[model samples]
Target: MITLSETSLDVQQAIQTATRLKAGAVNVFVGTVRDNAKGKAVLRLEYEAYEPMAIAEIKKIVEAAAAKWPLQGWAISHRVGVLQPGEAAVVVAVSTPHRADSFAACEYIIDTLKETVPIWKKEVLEDGEEWISAHP
Candidate 1:
């Protein structure tokens, strides 16, 4: 599954989707807004993306992960636009015949998404807002 929405993600739902495939292992990743980044107080965050490119890139990551791992199921979802502190920004889940594959594939998806996805974040601070790379 792949989706872009402003609504909150349901991890149970994601896991359910994965488990329905008779997977022996399931791995999940959830990224949330932190109150601070590099010691800078983060009042909130605003995310914007080149939607077409972002979605395409996300699909590519999912495909690569699936191909590289013996995955039985995969799902990735991301929330866009304004997000308050502590809200989830992204969720990824993977299920496979073995636990190791599930963990490795899930990590690959999230790390690659941060490195390759064309998503940008703006930190809203008490002083001002500044755009930053989605990855550290």
Candidate 2:
């Protein structure tokens, strides 16, 4: 499953999806908005995406990871709009019959998403704001 939503992501839902495959191992990675980036103090973050493109890119990452790994299940959820520090920005879950495959695929999913997804972020600081490229 893949999702781009403004609502909070449900970890349990992701877990359940993986569980359905009767996987022996499941790995989940949750990315949260941080209070600091570099020396800047972050008040919040706003995510905006060219929706159709972003979703297509995310789907491609999922497809590639699944094809390269022995994945029993995989899921990714990315949050949009305003987010406070410590709030989840994204989650990627992967399950497999073995621990190694699960871990490796989960890591690959997150890494690929960061590198290829078309989601852009605006850092909202106490004094100002700046837009950042998703991969940089």
Candidate 3:
């Protein structure tokens, strides 16, 4: 499953989607908006994306991960629009027959998604705001 949500991301929903009877491990990664960045106090984050393109890129990442491992299920939920500190910006969950596979697949999904997905973020700071690279 893949989602681009303007509202808060549902972490548990992502986990549930990836849970399977054949899976022994379900690894989850939740990325949250931080309170600070590079010596600046972060107030919030505003995310923008070409939704169709972003989703397509994320699907490609998932397919690549499945080719690398034996996966039971996988789900990715990314939040777009304004987000406050401590709010979940993204959720990635993957289920596999073993703990290691789940861990590796989950990591790959998040890392690759951040690097390749067409999601842009503006870091809103106490003093100013700036657009940052997705890979950064």
Q: Write candidate 1's Cα lDDT for 86-135 as tens digits.
A: 89898898899999999999999999998998888888987789998756
Model 2: number of backbone collisions: 0
By TM-score rank, best first, the candidates go 3, 2, 1
Question: lDDT values of the candidates?
Answer: 0.85, 0.86, 0.93
**Ten consecutive residues with minimal summed lDDT in candidate 3?**
127-136
How does candidate 1 score on lDDT? Answer: 0.85
Q: What's the lDDT for candidate 2?
A: 0.86
lDDT: the better of candidates 1 and 3 = 3
lDDT of 3 by residue, 74-104 (tens): 8999999999999999999999999999999
* Alpha-carbon shift of residue 95 in model 2 (angstroms): 0.5
TM-score against truth, every candidate: 0.91, 0.92, 0.97
Which prediction has more favorable TM-score, 2 or 3? 3
lDDT of 2 at 40: 82
Clash total of candidate 1: 0
Best by lDDT: 3
* Residue-level lDDT tens digits of model 2 in 3-44: 889988888888777664578899999999999987889999
TM-score of 2: 0.92
